[model samples]
Target: MSNRKIKTFAPKGTRDFLPVQMFTRNKIINLIKKIFEKYGYEPLETPSIERLDVLTGKYGEEGDQLIFKILKRGTGLDKVGVELKEFTVTDYKDIIDLGLKYDLTVPLCRVIAMHKDKITFPFKRYQIQPVWRADKPQKGRYREFYQCDVDVAGSSSMLADFEIIYMVYEILKTLGFKNFLIRINNRKILNAILEHCKIEQNKSFFVLSAIDKLDKIGKKGVINELKKKNINEKVIDNLLEIILLEGTFEQKLNELGHIFKENKIGNEGIEELKEIFYYLSKTDIDSDFYSLDLSLSRGLEYYTGPIYESVVKEPKIGSLTGGGRYDKLIGMFLGEDVPATGTSLGIERIIDVMTELNMIPETKTITKVLITTFDENLKQESINTTWKIRNSGINAELFFEPLRLNKQLSYANKKGIPFVCIIGPDEKKQNKVKVKNMKTGEEKLIENNKIVEFIKSITD
Candidate 1:
């Protein structure tokens, strides 16, 4: 054999979850899925790959660059004397036609566009899936991760927006997050600010991109970035003054009402916020859990109306969830526009935070009981007992070999199995099995037909 070493690690920015980790992840996902279903959203799943054109221009410039593109297959350049490393950036279009989806929303839009005829209007759906990005791996950031998204399409009412926010509130509370904030803003208000500053239409995205980084880069960094783009200094001052404006949700809205009195879109955005807050006040949601923050500009280009992000006050990790209304995204696929609103729960980050906070329960293994083979003669008895317990929905594993009883018990202890069932020749003849409580060292003789009940009594 060659002496070269084979790489055994997973690629960067991805992970291989062990059973212990998967148990917690599944628990969290199931909880989130339950909450989504409770809100009248149905489940939907789309393919992992999509046509390149379908995903290209939807996210902003920085987001577009993070997409993981997939090259075409079976285009035999080798037979034609071309090598794989010889291709240049200009040749990508000819060799690449597909890419991994950047997020769940784009593919959903494509689906609605293609199936609008058969589907009902105002379709509410939830999707829990993995999305790929070609980004530098960092703490709590991965190139491949799961996004749990719930969305409502074909509705223009701000009620849909409120539902999305309320569902976020409910989910975080359900997940045992006590100190978190749901920061809400409207793109129309940001657009009006840009207009008030006389920021050119072409450079609007650049200005927003800089503003989005205010949390990461700080005010001075944002100012420097804007200055680099030749934005007038006085205009930058005026823009920051409004963006950094602080007060209660109502107070800030009232202040902006005077600032943008003549600006139709700005006034419309402010009115939308007032209506959402009015709806929120009628509910039991705590006012401290949600707020209106003008600086909360989501990086995606598709968000056209109210946008919100959920963040934990403690660990200082980034957003746990993000999304907003995209009234025009579906229109890209269909001939006409359909109003859509949604939010995506960043499950990976949430799990990381839970782990840090010691919130995830200890779950070493799923096997509840181990059925040990006493010997070759009694192996059949153990096998039958294992199946009997399994039939009753108890997670039971049969020892593969008729090893010594102590060795089988050792295996159960190592795997953290709570109970062990022993059926030796004597017990088999007596029509009974010995069940040992691995945690307590207590042993009992359970009747053959009572095995399932005995296991459930303690485990459940």
Candidate 2:
């Protein structure tokens, strides 16, 4: 045999899903889609690959760095034998044109832009699809993963933000997430906080990115990161104090108002937060489930108003979900502003948390019953029995080979198929079939016509 062969290992940060994993993944996705649909969100899909320029400037500086760009075809990539050689290339602009989509929101904007005339205002959409990122993969992080995003466009009211928040609350509750908080903060408020701290604009993005990691790295670690960028130690200390402020959600908002009372942008943000909470208070939402975390500064540049993130209470891996209002994103492509609000369910993180907690539901085989032939001549009987069982709305599998009694029963048990139908000479003589309960190891001889009914009785 030729030694030339492909490598067996998957890429470093990607993984292959086995049968059990796929089942769980599908159930989660379907549940999310149903919730999205219930809220009047239509399904939308965009291509996995988009022009690099469209994704580059949209996700802020740190986010831009994590995009997986695609190189142009025929870029003079050298090759020798079975090994590939490094390209004699210099300019990124010349080599790269497309990139794997990093998130669903941007493409949603692009779609709205291209089809503005065809679509209605206040368009609601949900996209469940895989996105690629070139980040260091760790627990609950993947190079390629699915995001469940539901967004509504063309409405800037605080009501829009409130709806998004309510949707997120319901989603978490439905997903069996109990100890979770829907913490929200406004971009304008973050801007105001920076103004109070006297941090410069050029460094604000870097500052927000560093601060966003506060949950992962403690205050000291965040301070070290800020110091690397030459931010003054005093400024770092004050910034930490401002973002990490504590107390009741309302009381904290009052404190923020006092700090930025003279600052117009800050007061505007304060008023916005106040209005949101005032409206939220009128609803039946659990106060404990949704609240404010001033430190929750989502680092995305596009978020112009209310940034939201959902985090678990203990064993925090990262934000379980995140999104916000971006009033100007669609205008970049359509030349007209369309205000929108959204939330993205980080599916991989949810799965990881569920797996660690053993919350994934035990899923047995889809096939409810197994039909095995007693002998070579009984294959016809097996086929007929399998078809009848399936026709009666039961999942049934047939044994193609003539096997021993123990082997046939073992196959049924191994597959987790609860019922097995065996047709043999003695049963054929009596116009009956032997039904075995795989779970209880009990056998009963039933009339041939009642085989399907007998299985259904046990299953249903």
Candidate 3:
């Protein structure tokens, strides 16, 4: 006997979306796509695999650790540098040249830089695709997930940031999420606070990442975490105070301006945010839609300017969306700064939140009507009726099985095919069909000449 245990299971942190789940996912994606298109953001797609260098050193230390690095396929390497990432990949040039893209933004940035000459300035684009991460999967988090990103590049104007901010607000509202808040901060401001706190330059991302966890772990917990990283008590204490800096958005910006007045870059950050608010003031956006947040670090080192994170009012699913301005990321390829701002919705997290809230919409059946024949004698009549319905652009399904009447009705019920058009000897003799509403249990006779109209009146 063969001694092998064949296992049939999907990998951890990955999901196999059945029909129902796919319907929900597709509905959410389509809704996002419609909104994106309505905003005049053109769609762009890039290869799923990217060069190793394209991804590394962009997301910061902890973020880099979560990247799913592709391995060298060969058995042995000759003197390869064994640099450890989230996964171990030999730092050999030819060995590990390609890796699955970690996020849509990085690849999009590369596309913009490489094609700058051919592309128009102030370019806007949208991408809806999956990304891979090598992190522990939990609720609202996954190893493989989709990021619906929209970005505008080649402009540093505060208006660009405002457009992205307004876009985020509009997307949530369009998706029927009424209770949410957009948290805004500037990396420059966060950097200023870190500088004021005397956090070492090398460990800046560490501080940002730790503070980003404030929502998950409270203020005291953040301080405890920083202490574990050897951050001084005074530094941690000062950082916490700045994080809790209070008042209205303007008031908070004012306070930061006062504190960082002497600090050139810090004040510049504050001024930029103030101007963003100025531009936003002209819009009819809800006052509570966005607010200035001092502690929002966004946890990504690539963000050199304004940053944003959105949270739902309930269910506590962390950061439904995030994005920021990255002036240096595109420069990594172009060798010159290119101002870019964008935001990405975490599709998996959004789906999870909606599911928890029972907000996943009921799916509509594509096959609007199922045509069943009473017997082989009436099969041809059912077939002709099906084609007539199809010709009128109404979806209809004809059952070929010569099953009993109850079995045919049960099949329609199981498939959720809302309407069943039954063709029997009696109806055929009358040159008519019986349309049964599977949902309402109402049956009506429609003359064959008017069957298409009858179906449209109900199905359309």
Candidate achieving the largest lDDT: 1
lDDT by residue (1-460, candidate 3, tens digit) is 8888798787889999988788888888988888889888999999888888898888877777787767556624433786534554445455666678899999998998889888998889999988999889988888999999999999999888888888888878877888899999999998899888888898887788888888778887898889889999987888888888889888888888877879988998998899888877779887788888887887677888999979996897788999999988888888898899999999898888888888876775568999897887778888899999899998788888979989999998998999999888888889888999998999999999999988999986
Model 1, TM vs. native = 0.95
lDDT of each: 0.91, 0.86, 0.86
Tens-digit lDDT string for candidate 1 (1-460): 9999998998999999999999999999999999889989999999999999899999977888899987677656526666767555576678778999999999999999998888898999999999999999998899999998999999989999999999999988988988999999999999999898899999988898898888789999999999999999999999999999888889899999999989999999999999898899889998999989888888899999999999996687899999999999999889799999999999999999989998889899999999998888888898999999999899999999988888999999999999999998778889999999999999999999988888889889
Local error of candidate 3 at residue 343 (angstroms): 0.7
Give TM-scores for every candidate, taking all chains together and pairing residue i with residue i.
Answer: 0.95, 0.91, 0.91
lDDT of 2 by residue, 1-460 (tens): 9999988998877989887788898888888888888889899999999999889999877789999998787665423354446645576877788999999999999999999888897998999899999999987889999998989999988887888888888887898887888888889999999989999999988888898888788888899999999999999888888888888778888999888888998887777788788878888777887788777788678988888989896666878999999999999988989999998999989888988878888676778888888887878988998899899999889888888978988887776878888899989899898988877888999998988788888888
Clashing pairs in 1: none
Pick the winner on TM-score between candidates 1 and 2: 1
* TM accuracy, model 3: 0.91
Q: Order the candidates by lDDT, highest first.
A: 1, 2, 3
Residue ranges of candidate 3 with Cα displaced over 4 Å: 1-6, 71-90
lDDT value, candidate 3, whole model: 0.86
